[model samples]
Target: KPNEIVVVPGKVLGIGKLDHPVTVIALDFSSSALRKIKEAGGQVMSFNKALETFKDFKGKSVRLMKQ
Candidate 1:
């Protein structure tokens, strides 16, 4: 879905493409991943920033990725 918030426990790499925009929160992100995300109109943020920014979101709009 577009404008969704996703949290990655580890680093995010650019291995694929995004068809919709999203807010990616991760411990780290590859340069290519950052570029690709932005190119797709998505937003990226560090875990700490996400904590402060989305403190009120809880489980309503945040997704935790595992794999």
Candidate 2:
């Protein structure tokens, strides 16, 4: 979806490219992945921060991407 926040339970690796801007919340991320995400005009956050940002996150559209 467009303008959606992606939550990853594990680490994010730098292996591919992002076409559009997005907000990514993950446990951890590789340095390259962080750089790439920023370059793509995306925001990266931690799991805790995500939870804090979205207080009522019980039933939200959160997609998980695997490596």
Candidate 3:
């Protein structure tokens, strides 16, 4: 799970729960959304960080565009 990364834009709601290192980048965030990211021990990186990290990928199918 070395390359595992999560991306959330806008807001992250309670669809349920997740136990992973998800990096959230949004124009804004809700308190609930922020809590979930921290609780999961994930990082709340800025959009810039997201883009930079994505570029360091090794054949990732997912597309991450700069903001």
Cα lDDT of model 2 by residue, 1-67, tens digit: 6457888889999888887778899999999999988888888999888878988766666778775
Give the runs in model 3 whose Cα sits over 4 Å from its true position: 1-3, 52-55, 59-67
Candidate closest to the true structure, highest lDDT = 1
Model 1 TM-score (2 dp):
0.88
Best by TM-score: 1
Off by over 4 Å in 2: 58-61
- Give each model's whole-structure lDDT: 0.89, 0.84, 0.60
Counting clashing residue pairs in each candidate, in order, gives 0, 0, 0
lDDT of 3 at 59: 65
Candidate scoring better on lDDT of 2 and 3:
2
TM for candidate 2 is: 0.82
lDDT of 2 at 56: 72
Clashing pairs in 2: none
Model 3: how far residue 27 lies from native, Å: 2.5
- What's the distance in Å from true for residue 24, model 1? 0.2
